[model samples]
Target: MTRALSHGDPLEGLPSRARIAELILSSRPPLDTYVGWQHYRTHCGLLVPAPTISPRQWSMLPESRQYDYDLYRELTNANLPLQDTPMHDKVGKLIRRRLSSNTRKKDDPTRAGVMISGWGNYGKTASVCSAGAVFEEQWLALHRCLNPAALPGARDLHAPVVYVSTPVTATPKSLCASILGFFRAPTRKSATLPELVRLVADSLHDHGVKALILDDISRLRMHRADDQDVLDLMRAFMSLDVTLILTGVNIPGIGLLREAMWNKTTRQWELPPLESTRIHGLEITQTEHRFDLIEIDRFRYVTPKQIGVFVDHLTGIEQHLRLLNAKVGMLTGGTMPEYLMRRTGGVIGLLGRLLEDGAHEAIGGKELIDESLLDEIVLRRDGPEQAPDEPVIPTDPPSAAKPPQQTKSTRPRNTTFDDHGPASATGR
Candidate 1:
């Protein structure tokens, strides 16, 4: 008799990739969904669902062997072995190889080095932290989350990974002092950086820490020369056997960790916009059959109405996938993908706004999004508000696109917040 498995069963050669899939056939989630899921995982790491028997007794199916993402394994458990799901079993190995390459580097003591750099909001901090967390779980699962014995450590820290958040005001002295503060609380008198670093290197050497993440490097700005407090601190971490992951909003000054630490062989990855279409396929594809879809007469891109509908009917996995798609599109486009993609100056801080004023005007007894109604929306948004609920005679010619209720501004006067929250500066 074929035993049906509940959770990711090791005995089942392949795990059902998606939680809810086609009734007749069982298989991996579609490729589009996989791509979108990868993007989200790039940001949230283990938070992304991986096919794994969760660390729970009820779901446990021990006799089976399954494959799963290493990051997912690190997140849930390190022991009492379980298996990875099918899709995971396939991609998990590749992901692990990449993770290992970044961590282990090359064995040649001085030859291989590391530098993680990318444009702002490229998901660097999140990625490195995820990597660090995985490495920790892999190496330190036997120990408490944070061992107390290391608190006064000149000793007792045999760990291979170190996760540290470099502060905005970090200087050569402050940076060294920060590491020392972690090892031994700083004195009433601020210990000089040389004093701090000597101890830090000694402590790291004593403990055998292997990898370090210096995140948010843009925050640290101490422009001093080599051998002076500056060069030594930047160069110090590389001396240890630890793999170093340097994260910054943009390329750090002089690129590479520091002039001294720069070596030829570091791997780099730049994160880009996630694919919303893929996400759409994952969450909303199943329901496409429910909709009436004889090939359309004209070309029409997605609309908010369609988005709203997709948001309304989908749930659980479907909903999550759609939201991720929406985010990916927004992240890739500057709000007005409707106006065409040409206007994205690429700086979100300087990106334009999306006003519902046009949406409001267009809502009045309107069929298609006509130019006049759209123009009126633009006018109304740019122009001052008419007396509360007073009929606004739109400057543009009449159109079928707007409903009468829309021109009246049902929105309460002086309203500052949206149904979601205080209005986004761009939304306004």
Candidate 2:
């Protein structure tokens, strides 16, 4: 009898090329339903780091082997491990604490949520999703990987996390529909707003969802009636005993917090007076008061400590690189770090893209990275305009050695006088 291949089984030979290709295709998680979320959680937890091969060994490999190796390297480079940064640490700690506290309070009418606010590419969504994944892992372990509320014979999925991005033009009905869609729940076009809300709430309870992440939340503008309704819908979700996480670019600057004032003493945002009849009956204050807002900013390279931290981050990226001719201190060394800082403006997303593109170029050509190679690459900025404060690299500090003496021009002097004398003789 032949044994069935397990996920851990090694892929090798000509046949392994097809296998690796399949794995690459399936690497991206659907991330909409419970099953999809499970796939993502498992993928995140079970990433197998690609093996490194020396240049000499690579050169000796057969053509087929070289193709397989290159394919695998491409896969690994695209999904390099998430590095530990100050922002990640801060967000992770806050999320863990909030989830723990929410889980303990079984009778609280409303659970506090967390808002991860920052410029795009500052890793707001990544940080929140990672934290959610970690929380789900621990939650499952505590429950022994079984849904405590699930029936013995039911086919319900035990999803501890539900992630959904707000629609580009979000409405209350649409937002609720988005959540229900994650659970693959049936939704009739004729269903009322209240019906959709109930469906979403019931689905969350039925699936044992502990955390709900609403990404790109700033898409909802407060000025619009539909968006206002969407905000109210979010408030309703808070009461369903789930830790709601909202992530967006410049959340405060966006209209999400319009007319909301910050109270330093309470360390919470206070909603405006309930003068508008539209929100008079709804609980508008709880969301602002309960949700803890956290900001993630790009790396700063001004101070000595700041420079050290930035270099440390680059070192982390260097360690994960699989380039054949990559050298020590390739990214973190002397002027190279400054060059990268200028190129990316210390935005982690831009930095990662620049490095990833450079790596591909390196693999195809010299198998090494340098300032000149990176200079040829350009990155697209999709986020809000970079702030003025985070300007281009500062002028270099003055050197102690005297500057080289200026040299006199070697060209002939201006020819206006010489031409004028010749012109006069010709005119006469």
Candidate 3:
């Protein structure tokens, strides 16, 4: 269950310094793997509720009061859900199906292989990592429950999910070695490529791995010999009926997998760029798609609701605050939306950092975050501002005469690095 710290606690109303320190000291990281999931909902962090507190109630408390700081600390540290769109949910569903017990023959055109391609930071890694983590945990739990004898002297026990990222200097031998290392296979200084591949395939078979995720596959600098070796290894896995998922910012051309006839068998999905921007209660088209038409003199951004959720996660103040309202009110007209969006380019990774930094600044003082501190933080990262009169999106109530068009940017990308994919099969 997603635990919510109680705001109704009578002690919360008290101003105990010790109470504040204890809560801060008690803040610890969530259990990584080895965690028990009652169902899929409890397994993934995406479904966890965002921690919320009343901003109005928070500001009324003096900073000297432990309660205020305690709230501030928890709000700042809260693991807010990265709002998953319908598309992300669909992709996750596809991966889940791949992990099913059903198997396809090598010649079966419906082989379970997929490629998630998108711009950097769009949440590609999150979806795969979450799915892989949950599936692996559930599989381990099931294994021990059903095969108790297997646990006592289980030499055949192996992880079901293997995640690896392409190294900067990726080669077939090094890549195989990385996979073998994950299974704790003894390293032979002069092991041949075929030997390493055999070790990987045998270990995966022994452990009963059902899925593999190769994230950042674009980083593989394939030489002629390395290319052939990779193809051979992939073919071997395909022969074993292992499901493969590849994620990358810029996927290699279909030709890289030509020997394996990958394009004929693999499914591909992409995160397109933003299509429209919401400004001054009006939705304006930025492009038919990110690649189509000319660039317009309009702001490129996320919807009010999308950004609003993040703001609420940061402040825990009021869930009702719009992006502009929070900016002007909390920062006291410190920064403008145009500058903020342009600097971060509406990337969630950068936006999250900005809000977190601002929270830290506010937590350092008696008052809520002000313009000066926020400006300092922005200036240090984004440098001096540009376009002084960059039109601010007015938060004025929209006219009911005609409702504005609401179009969401469907194109997304992964912006942060997390340990995931087919290279490492470390069971938590």
The candidate that wins on lDDT is: 2
Best by TM-score: 2
TM-score of every candidate: 0.38, 0.80, 0.55
* Worst ten in a row by lDDT for model 2: 1-10
Query: Which residue ranges in model 2 land beyond 4 Å of their true spot?
Result: 1-15, 151-154, 259-285, 382-428
Per-residue accuracy of model 1 over 289-389 as CA lDDT, tens digit each: 11111110111224665333222222111212211012223222333333311221221111112122322232223412233444453221323333321
| Candidate scoring better on TM-score of 1 and 3 | 3
Error of 3 at 288 (Å): 27
In model 2, the Cα lDDT at residue 100 comes to 96
Specify the poorest-scoring 10-residue window by lDDT in model 3: 287-296
On TM-score, the stronger of 1 and 2 is 2
Clashes of each: 21, 0, 17
* Candidate 3 lDDT, 1-428, residue by residue in tens: 11234657422444345654564476333222112212333434432222333445445546565455455454433444545544356567767666653343436532446666544555677767777776676766877634232345567645566666655566778777766655556879898877877887776676676676667765644455675556446545654556777676534232242111113223232223223333354232211111111101122335666445434433332231212113324521234444455555544455556655665555536334444555678523332343422322213334578767899888876758865667656754
Residue pairs whose backbone atoms clash in candidate 2 = none
Give Cα-based local distance difference scores for all models. Answer: 0.38, 0.78, 0.50
Poorest lDDT segment (10 consecutive residues) of candidate 1: 290-299
Q: Sorted on lDDT, highest at the top, how do the candidates line up?
A: 2, 3, 1
lDDT of 2 by residue, 397-417 (tens): 356998799999899888775
**What's the CA error at residue 210 for candidate 1, in Å?**
1.4
